[model samples]
Target chain A: MAFQIVINLIIACMWMFLNESYTFASFVAGYLWGILLLFLLNRFIPDTFYLRRVGKVIKLIFLFIRELVLSNIEIVKLVYKRQPQFEPGIFMLPLDLKSNWEITLLANLITLTPGTLSVAIAHDNSHIFIHAMHIDDIDESIRSIKDTFEKAIMEVTR
Target chain B: MIETGIDITLNISVSLFILIGTFFVLSSSLGIARFPDIYTRLHAATKASTLGISSMLIGTFLFLYAEHDIVSGKLLLAIVFILLTAPVSGHMISRAAHKSGVKPVTANRSDAYEDALQKHRKNS
Candidate 1:
């Protein structure tokens, strides 16, 4: 998956080089162009099913951005409150991620969001240890992570 | 005059981004100072800094791309690197912190590690 993304990047860069313009707009154009080309190539090629669903990837990023903004606001609000009312804890999140890469990506995504930091992974790799600052319900938190980030990752990396 | 008007608009938008970015950065610092524990502080520092710095970089990219008509590859790469690695660093820090026995300030309902340790002790 990483290799395919790198190839797409190279193709995007080559597109810009050919166009003689390195502006952001042209770079996006090139990236989309590369994606289209790769999609066509995948249709004809065997065992090259690495590249992702572009729309799903875009949706995942948008979801991440929304989470980022919303969590930032939540943290800001938490910080401004006169009384620090927090329910912070460390909990084990059981994983369904199959690969090391998928687990690492999920951990990173959890940490990158505000109010949640992934502390450790189990020695057996069955669960991830996470510290969340305002977890009203542990099940809900895990459900949201699984539904939003993990689901999107499964979609894109499939 | 028309050019000046465009410049003014660009300047205002650029300033807005910078200001908002700085505000988040400041909030993150405040969080670090005020939060109860190492893990929560790490959360604030990592997330806010990532978004804050990205916002500032976005402002810079927009200003340069709009005003000078050149998108800076270096700035773009910097933003990408920061976004990709911030979480990794946070993960490493928290992992190390936990391994080194940094306890949470007030955990309401969790002792999974302790339970695991007890189970291992009983089995052995």
Candidate 2:
């Protein structure tokens, strides 16, 4: 991925030098041209094209933002309630993610989204403990996490 | 600084965003005061505060761009940095609290971490 980015940037710079135009527009055009060139030559590359990963990353960001907004609204409602009655508990989440960074990212996203905070991880990286402000049904909450954030993360990383 | 129609519109929107941000931040503080346990308090402190600060920063960014025609990269960077770091800090605090055996106020359901720890000890 780094090599591909370096090649694209070099192409962009060479295009700017060749055209004698050091403007942002020319650089963007050159970048687009580089993308097209790379797309055409993608078959020869061993790994998947970098733009696909970039697109997946953008999708993950949108997914996160959507979750954040929805949960924030929920938090607002909970905050203003006259008599708040909710079950807050700690539960285990068995992780599908491997690697320290992936687990860290998952933990961060869970905490950032309102209502759920990741508390700790198992020594073998098999499970994460989460403390949620409201868990109507433990199984349901676990499934939602698996479906939304976990699925989106797996799509991006794997 | 100009009193153009667009400038007025921008000013209104900026104020609107800041107002919303302040409301969330205030409610989050209320949450911290009212919540019974450390874990519940963390939910309020981390999530609401994050959205509140991000909204305020965005409003500031828009205001600067509209009034001065200068995009402030620093404000944008600050928003990103907060979004990135707030969760880590929240996680660290919660983990520390749990490790030190600070039980939650109302855990109607099972405490999985404590169960796991007991199971680990038995195995060892």
Candidate 3:
């Protein structure tokens, strides 16, 4: 990750030189260009896992954004309804990913979304505690996270 | 005239983003006030407010870019910082709340932590 960031910065600088603008847009564009370039050059790199998963990463981001927007709308409705009904609960989520980075990213993504927040991780890293605002079925939420968020992350990390 | 046309479009879009962002923030505030417990309130403050501030910053970024052609890396930095720190802080706060003996209003059937704590107490 650190090496990738350095490469991204170097690409951004090169982009500044090419564009001669030295602006933020150019830098972001350059960073994206760097990512794309690295992605293309993944065959030669030793760590092919992360570079190859760029598409999955982008998909994960889009999924998060869509969920974020939908959740925001739900929260708005919840706040406006005459008698708000929130069945908030915290449940222990058994995790599949073992790495620290994967766990952290999963937790962060959960916390960022609309109704759920990741509270803590087990000492053994086997499970995470999540608090959800409208959990009708714990099994369903767990399956959803595992299928979408956790599955997407596994594509990147594993 | 052509420049004015572009300006008007930018203005409208920026305003729209701002409006959406403000709406989220307002809902979050309502959530904070109406929610019964600390855990739920944390949910409101962290998730909704983070999105709200982020959307507003996005509007600011768009306006500045449209008007001045300045790429404010600072605003991007701020957004990244908020995105990274906000959830971590929320986790810490909620963890603290739990550890300090605050209970969730409607917890599910099982708690791994409670079981672990009991076993440790029995051993000690």
Candidate 4:
């Protein structure tokens, strides 16, 4: 668990430091020290860590990227196909996986994708209602999201 | 002559920072517009805006550092405060929205989390 936490912290630092705008010696010093402490503690903690199915994650990411690119292209085409008829509405999608972090990631990913946005997560975490940009066939849209995107998330999180 | 190079570099960085900041702000707005609903919109706007404003503020600080002295440091301090608060506020807003019966995208199987919430509500 500590190792996982340390890795997460390192990831945060890496993300922050990538910009490298400021020249604060103290900031850099503090960052290094925090990382070192986390690393040392990580070695001692025995926490149940989810071993990501790497091959699955890679495959899913690839599939997601493909779909994302395709989704964007389709959205652009729809926009350009004059006389745009967007029959948009809210879709209530049932959540399969229950992990809070997993659900959060899934929702964020949906938001990032074109044409679909995760509007609200039911307080019960049972459903995630999304507002579709154009709901021509809500069922079809749900099927695509569930089969393609949400399933991939299951593979990663499970 | 010595100050000329510093001034030009500083000007360029300032413009770049401002441009990036503006882009982020726009992106956040776009996120709000294009995202599905309130919760999603909040997430998109908050994430993008934080990064965007921070970049702009950082750029501003750097430009100020190069151009002036001392006073600009105060500006950096203010930016730090904003960076600290924005995410927290966004989280609180989203959580409140969620608690007030905001519907999420419908899920597939049984939701244990929802059961817990329901039970808690009942007991209380």
On TM-score, the candidate that comes out on top is: 2
* lDDT for each residue of candidate 4 in B1-124, tens digit (9 for 90 to 100): 8689878888898899889777776766765666455654555554556556767888878876776664576667776666545544654565566568765433242223345467768988
Q: List the residue pairs that clash in candidate 1.
A: none
Compute the interface RMSD for each candidate structure: 1.6, 1.3, 1.9, 8.1
Q: Each model: TM-score of chain B?
A: 0.85, 0.92, 0.89, 0.82
lDDT of 4 at B117: 61
The residue pairs in collision within model 2 are none
Could you give candidate 3's per-residue lDDT for residues A69-142 as a string of tens digits? 67777677777888977787777888989889999889988887767888888778988988888767778778
Tens digit of lDDT per residue, candidate 1, span A93-152? Answer: 889888998898788788866577887787778888888786667788888898888898
Model 4 Cα lDDT, one tens digit per residue, A1-158? 34665665575566457657545664566466665655566546465432335567888667744654454444444434446444455657888879887787677566545566565577778887665555566678778778877788887766
Candidate 1 vs 3: which has more lDDT: 3
- Chain A TM-score for each of the predictions: 0.69, 0.91, 0.68, 0.62
Mark the regions of model 1 whose C-alpha exceeds 4 Å error after superposition: A1-52, B117-124
lDDT of 4: 0.62
- Per-residue lDDT of candidate 2, residues A59-116 (tens digit): 9888777877777787788889989776888888999999898899899888866578
Q: Who wins the lDDT comparison?
A: 2
- State the weakest 10-residue window (summed lDDT) of model 3 chain B: B107-116
**Model 2: per-residue Cα lDDT over B1-124, one tens digit each:** 4568788999999999999999889988998898778988888888888889999999999999997999999999999898889889998998899889898865565678888988999999
Ranked by DockQ from best down, the candidates are: 2, 1, 3, 4
Which ten-residue region of model 4 chain B has the weakest summed lDDT? Answer: B104-113
RMSD per model, one decimal = 4.6, 2.0, 4.5, 10.5
Using all chains and alpha carbons, the TM-scores for the candidates as numbered come to 0.80, 0.94, 0.81, 0.44
DockQ per candidate: 0.59, 0.73, 0.55, 0.07
What are the per-residue Cα lDDT tens digits for candidate 1 across B38-68? 8778878888878899899989988998778
> B103, model 1: CA deviation in Å?
1.3
